[model samples]
Target: MSSAALPTSALAISAAIRSGSLSATDVTRAALDLVSARDGEIGAFTTVTAERALNEAQAVDRLRAEGSKLGPLAGVPYGVKDLFDIKGLSTLAGSKINRTRPPADADAVLIQRMTAAGAILLGGLNMGEFAYDFTGENAHHGPSRNPLDTKRMSGGSSGGSAAAVAAGFLPLSLGSDTNGSIRVPSAFCGLYGLKPTYGRLPRTGTFPFCDSLDHLGPFARTVGDLALCYDVLQGWDGGDVACVDRPSEQASQELAKGATGLRTAVAGGYFRRGADPSAIAAVDRAAHALGASEEIDIPDVTRARAAAFLITNAEGSALHLDNLRHRAEDFDPDTRDRFLAGAMLPASWYIAAQRFRLQFEAAMRKVFSEFDILLAPSTPFSAPLLGQKTMMLGGSEVPLRPNIGIFTQPISFIGLPVAAVPVRVDGPMPYGVQVIARPWREDLCLRAAAVIEAAGVAHMTPSSL
Candidate 1:
């Protein structure tokens, strides 16, 4: 279990563990040592649960000793975004106000499942307060510095998750995508991140940023690790109303099918409208790998973005109505305005946004009827300055953090599966692109992403101080 033998994928870790060449405790300890050595700069985890992770690692090793079956993720250690509820731990959601909150009563379903599969939970990671922003710059928790470039932003609200994996602290991390949070940071940090079809993973225990758009997923150094986590995490969680009772066979059956003959297109129009050159080039590279055709537009992306904004604001504000009324001062200034702004949105506008989502979903289904996969930039640019609010995108200055959701919103608006691949490109904030598919079509999305990643046409940011 030397750090020299650190795995690049969770599947590889599982193999090592199963063959008695490595133990879960060794993998967990190595991850902790790396975090100890590196996280002061990365600032990925807000709370490092070292003792607990070690205990869990020992438990996993005990499972192996008892001749019990280990899951595909066995012996892997991953950071969890702070927003998810971890048993006996307060679900901070990266907010200062939550300092007084009590520990969780039980583990989130996804956490329990990963643990059952022998994965060790390292700790809760940093994020935008209450998952309100796109940049992983936390005023209270401190910004999650990009591993590739310390001065740049880590894409939020899953910034820490991305940094943790990208910095080699661990090969895998669990993150949530509410308007590209997972994909954006993963792109910036140069890692593989999947925003599975909405509800592909249950949201029952994750803090809600926007109920309509929230998605739970995995971040890793390779597509194979993404699949390993997905297989362990996806299933029917009866408590989560959005969870569809798909057969448990989904991940294993779909992953290696490959993207042969799949009709793919580069998303143009709004998707291409205001993105950085690095972002555009990354998508372009992916297009060539998939043999994608020229630009195809998904109508009304601008309006859809607005609608998504209204809904997110309204829902998020409502969720914290009591807190805003009394403890407003305790909230982070960067996100406080966003929450208060949401509180002022007219109820009627919120209703219209929901109705629009239905129509939007219908329109997307029609588009998918024609194409198998849609390719687009996960973030409009590579990571920006830690507190940056603007960027020159496609010849126009746009709000960087908020506008980062431009390309990702339209696809997630309809509950589609998207596997975001961080292609190697020369930049401070390494760019990444997403391969999106129709709802429940992660098979196609993963296939296209794997192809793009395997081509090695895109450059990956190296981890060096």
Candidate 2:
């Protein structure tokens, strides 16, 4: 295949495969070769299922030869974060302890959905331990280095998902977002990531992390690809308690409707304070591009963030209580300490946080009633150095790990859908803006993102590496 064809978008690849202009096996081989050549420096994948990928690709080819209809993702190559259960592979969830568990009996709900749609899985990607990190530093499986700048953090716990797409290893990948895993990495790696409305996509077969807040979504190089993945992953699954039993919302079909008549606003108040100037500028550029002059403040956002922390701690601790008792030493020290602390939190604190969450969600709903879409900085700044501990936020140095999701936590805390669109900047690394919409209104978020992408204000320029 020509170099130009090698890095084509997922849609393009699918079309080519359908037309017999490209073979799925060849495309899969090229992707595997790229991963083998570049993953040593990037460390995006924890496991690369070469044989499985090739076999799946060959099946697609055979279907075409037999004149059978193909799925939308016909020959696209993709992967999922380690948390997802890939049949026969221990669902690591970025923890060493999980390696000892028996292999998964079947694929995750999303994995099954993707494969049925004809997208071959490359393998399980690396992630933050137990999905409790935002810096993308996995002590056991070294940090998934930033494709743009190896020294910088890739953002986590979906770091590898974002890094793979950004580095052109694959056109799409699946990731989970509890606080801001999907959006943060999208911001840092210059990819288009979707953290769909909480429960929009089923989380069955994925390891738990703050059950109330955890979400599974996709990372892609383009808004359309993101929407396509979202559409495919839609539908109800009785296996996941949180899965909404609603008909699939055809976001990709609706994307062409554009952002017309949408009431757009830039978030002010808590969102404006303590953000990096560059992050602020990116939001400004996006807001300007979308003709959004109105500024709205989300009520009690700080308290919302605190509530998220308390809820996450309590719930995550509860889920891992047994492991904490038996395999505490197997966890990353940071994760172990946080889980231990959470196990000690009073049940009253968790109850209060849940009660407060309802109030916060109500406030946000009112804001959504007035505005169709809201824009905010995805991260406070661009990717930080891998081992860097402190950052100058609002002129005060703060610990980097927790603060990186400062702008994202409050939004996800309320189960709002957000599309993280990378802002084109004149720096070595990239930054992004969040296009947020009310629950189940991912169409609005994606429409606004498509508009920004068309204007050249937001894009995914593949990393040079």
Alpha-carbon TM-score of each model against the true structure? 0.96, 0.98
TM-score of candidate 2 versus the correct structure, residues matched by position: 0.98
**lDDT at 352 for candidate 1?**
96
Error of 2 at 273 (Å): 1.1
Residue 452 in candidate 1, Cα distance off native in Å = 0.6
lDDT of 1 at 246: 82
User: Residue-wise lDDT of candidate 1 within 120-157, one digit each (tens)?
Assistant: 89999998899887888998989998887888888888
What value does the lDDT take at residue 243 in candidate 1? 86
lDDT score of model 2?
Answer: 0.91
Itemize residue pairs with steric clashes in candidate 1. 424-458, 424-459, 424-460
- Per-residue lDDT over 223-278 for candidate 2, one digit per residue giving the tens place of the 0 to 100 score: 99999999999999999999999889889998887779999999998888878777
